[model samples]
Target chain A: MSKNQTVEQRYLPEIQRKEIDELKTTVKGASQKIIADNIARMKKADSHRPDTMKYFDDIANLFGRRQQEIEAEKQKGKKIIGYLCLFAPTELISAADAIPVRVNSGWYDTSKLGDRVVPVEVCPVIRSTIGAKMIELSPFLEQSDALISVLTCDGMTKLSEILSDQKTIWGMNVPRVKDSTQSLRFWSAEIKHMKTQIETFTGNKITRNSLKEAITTSHRATKAFRRLQELRKGNPVIMGQDAMLVNQAYSWDDKKRWTEKTEALCNELEKRVQQKDWVCSPDTPRVMLTGTPMFWPDSWKLPALVEEGNPKGIIVADEQCSGERILNDPIGVDEWSMDDMLNAISERYLMASTCPCFTSKDGNEDRINWLLNKVKEWNIQGVIYYVLRGCMLYAMEYNRVKKALDKINVPVYYLDTEYTREDVGQLKTRVEAFMELLNARIDF
Target chain B: MSTAKEFWRWHEYRHTMPNIAPVSDDIITAGVDVGSVGSKAAVMVNGQAYSWGITRTGSNSPESAKKALDLALKDTALSTRDLRYIVGTGYGRVNVPMANKAITEIACHARGANYIWGSSVRTVLDVGGQDIKAIKIDATGRVVSFLMNDKCAAGTGRGMEVFADLLQVPIEEIGAMSLKVEAEPEPVSCTCVAFAKTEAIGLLRKGWSKEKVLAAYTRAMAVRMANLINRVGLEPALVITGGQSKNVGIVSRIETLLGVKCLPTPNWRDGGLDPMVAGAFGAALLAKALYEKTQQI
Candidate 1:
């Protein structure tokens, strides 16, 4: 491959190409450098300050615009209803032409907000979510045509009641199914009920034929995304972080434009893969990002983990609201028949559906095992578990996860952050040391 | 010899000279606090606080306590032999071997608050370096119901420290800077300190004045603190203590939010009298009562 040849000229896996394209077009006019700089400044400032206040206004404005856009789209004859939980009938709702937004309370400060609705001692996430509601930060409360909340944790269970009091809210009692058969039954009922509720909310009857068609389209999109992940795994440099950003944007933004951009980017990446041409840097070490994404300014530590530590630093996977957990393992479709396809999608979704907020003593173990398997398969050197300061659920389970990971001899770096950049100096030292340990192990 | 050298030599001689110790047991008692940020010890001998000392809580708190205790004993010219009993409090209370018993800071704080500001106080808000707690007290300064901020450092002194580091100012300066604002800036929305940074930057880009933003952040935290205060139910004459008590902005904001005036005692500078020492003082008082009862018997 010649130096003049563009990344698009190289042959790349179709899925990898699409993900890269998606990342490129996610944020309009905002360069990665600018975002990185802003995040750096946020990390450097004291956790409480005028600087943090400014950041909040900026994020709130962005959310405000997005909410209005969604509302306008609904007014233009688009059927859209927002769902709260990750498993609140996403495929079914989307099939009915509704948009499901994951309700994350991690975005706002809870001090005042928690006071209005919850006790100070409750989980910080709950307090913050209530805080968001108290301050009217969540556009969903006012703009959402309808809201769906699943009982996953004590926090969510309580949230259901709070949300149901609002107009156009639906509460689904998601049964905890331990057995495979029971799981399938529960999911099937959920999908059917969700489809009906969505249809009722929109006042448009969804035909079986239309439902099947929508399911197929969603299935294709998910497959393409997963295939991209596989390609990136096979040849790491072919799809970089920017590509991943674009892919997430594709999922979160205007579907039509995102689809067009993603298709183009995928074609470009495929060309790069064909020529076996990519940016090759010294491989430092590989690690998986576990736990939640630092919500304040998004964890500034990721770049520090990669750049300062000089590690291969593949964010192999995450159990966070912001990463692979948000878009991994799409609904599967069997080619045999449409019924088989629907069943396959539902089954896959059920098996793969896990949230960090899920409450069970064993939930942490399940998450650890899942990530450990991925690390082994991907040949990752270590695991970095970055948790937010006030997240009680994750904080309680950290020692358990650390003990489990220790059994596998995978060094884990447990970083507790308030999601502020001021702690960057401390964070950098920790990440550097963690990387050094990984390197030392390899050398030994 | 030069006058400065002669003065230093005289000081050294004075340090070596032994003083005549007071020949009284005086029911001397001491309290030790093993806090995350630091440790403190207070000695009350014969119904009077004779000496108090503070030091950093190093890796081993017992050693820190021994050092703090030694310093207090030296100041009062007393010895461990003269002390009747010792009480321990704070996170590392269990680690204090010499303590006769460990008391929860909640109980100790209520007692201390009552001692400083008569028994009429109904609510006590103690904001420490690493945690924040709210306690409801009865007419006698006993804890009725209490609420704690949990393990997160947000909305505590640690949160203020993070802000101080970001703004390139001392933590003490934050409260003063906050007071200069005419209007409150937008509130940071994220619960995690990490995400709040991003929210902070977004605010910066929108051209918000620094003082306004700082004021808003203080108000937001005050709101969080107020939540805890409301949980135990607000009462007249609320008292705020702890290392964060120095932040007038936070104290004022909290007072406004709760619609109450917060009172600080004369001993506010002594790290709110080391809750552990307060506990020890209460125990000594109890011992005095017990002694009186045995005399009657």
Candidate 2:
């Protein structure tokens, strides 16, 4: 096989090649439609949406203008590094002078194509990621020189192996036991190894100075994100779905630009707060959404329904990895030394994570505490805990989180769903019922 | 040549008390619940259920809502315009053009169950046309926690109707017929209605009687409902509501499975309100509260 040959050209015959060509068109069209429809819904999501939101919304339009921007960046001789899980440190990818793009997709049509490679019961995130890669439809996946595959779950681990057939893969072994000295040391070594692999792949040595700059870049974004969280506390000026879109854009946007735009959005929200221009009435139910990460297109459903009631309930905050958790949990770097920075990054990514991948002695006390704090801070009346079907780790942790919320008298509605739109009606009823419960409680 | 004509059809009816004359100043409220398989409307006067009607939901939801409300208002001096407030519920709640407010059937059922059986009811299991819900409510009929069946049509009124049609038994007779079996048979598949139907066909091939097949299905539905009920947990004075509560086979089996008898559904002041009208009745009760709140404001 030639180095420059495509997967289809090498593996498929002429007839199958033509079939794939037609299928690729369908996949591309459907993916764009999903992105466009979601963006339109998001723009009209609130009547008082800040003008700064358009920037983040455009970046979330996966196959749109963002692709041209990525192509231009590639033309400038910068390597694009695609990643899936948050465990893959984005700062390290930036340190190697490579642009990091989170390539996890939430489109249903592309996930169907993945059935050919993986079983149907595998996680939709894994399926869509691999499915987009197989058809070469995702511009981010196509442009990425290498994918940083973090071993977070069995599905992701297997996904890396399947992706390795067509792409350059750098696999990271995340320690499942998050709260121990031994695991910390093990993770630090793994990060160091990843640093070396990324440096070699980009042919750029990650000096201590470049690594510090990268850490500072993410820290600036985190600063802006923390400010946004502060604004969301008292009265929700921004809806959860819009805030999640901002966080999601951080995965694909240029770090400095994302920080600037987020800071601007936060500024608008601050103004709205002073003007008392709340997105929803004060009596509306303040819901805190947690559980599995919701990516673009598919992320719109639950959050949209959350706010689409007579009084229109508001998602005051969310603890999802794709929402508030992005650019959060910043690294606490004491020394500017390479080893210390690497150790801090490893610790921040591993120990501070509430992602259900790690098993702590207290059974997700960290996640529960994080959720409870959010609930209290926002005065959230309810919690909508939705798990994407086949994402078992989040589903498994629901009962524990529900039990914790029960102690605080906050109601949690557990919804199990996939990427399809088939169950929207059913989900709407449940979500509305939950909103009704919260509203009635507020009336008393 | 099977000549049995639509064994699953259930008659629709409207009833109102002739003794209580219509008072113009009284607070009038209506609740229209347009479910997937059936539609119901309950009219309440000053928080009391005055009249109610049940009908099969047609293709057009707004029409169904109108038809149900018209039936409930039939032979009554009060017209639809006289109602102070109307609350719509169930799956087609949003489509009710005349409703001033639309509340979910979950909240409505808990409220209706409280009104029907009193505030002692803590857990309410409502088996409706397309789904089942196990709701845990407080003394004030406020929903504390509730669980609805997933996006499946098993263990619901619709599933029971399918069984009735398959067995060539009238829908109303299914409960009594299922009880006629001398010994309890093994339940059918408790997973899916489609799979259970296939299993029932297999049982019939094995020469099992229709009564035994009906028993097996009802038992399976009861087991599924019991699982959901246990998941929500059984508090004291559990009340069963909705269309499936009319079927004693499922209700009795669920009682035996949970080892707790459900509270009886008495004829609401001899108005002959069927258990199927719980959602509508509950909505009517809520409408009365809303009307009163507005009046005070």
Q: Specify the highest-DockQ model's number.
A: 2
- Worst lDDT 10-window in candidate 2 chain A: A6-15
Query: How high a TM-score does candidate 2 get?
Result: 0.96
Each prediction's Cα lDDT score? 0.58, 0.86
Q: After superposing the true interface residues, what Cα RMSD does each candidate give?
A: 17.9, 1.0
List, residue by residue over A44-126, the lDDT tens digit for candidate 2. 76876899988887787777777898899899999999998888889998988899998887777778778777778888888
What's model 2's lDDT at B205?
98
For candidate 1, what is the TM-score?
Answer: 0.50
**Best candidate according to lDDT:** 2
Q: In model 1 chain B, where is the ten-residue run with the lowest total lDDT?
A: B7-16
In model 1, what is the error at residue A264, expressed in angstroms?
Answer: 3.8
Tens-place lDDT per residue, model 1, A301-416, is 46444433333354444455455654566666556364665576567655675555544443334566677777777666677776665556667777777777778877676666
TM-score of B chain for each model?
0.80, 0.96
Misplaced by over 4 Å in model 1 are: A1-68, A110-112, A139-141, A234-244, A247-251, A256-260, A266-280, A293-314, A335-345, A356-369, A389-404, A419-425, A442-444, B1-297
Chain A TM-score, structure 2: 0.95
- After superposing candidate 2 on the true structure, give the runs of residues whose Cα lies further than 4 Å from its correct spot: A1-15, A362-364, B1-4, B267-270
Q: Docking category for candidate 1?
A: incorrect
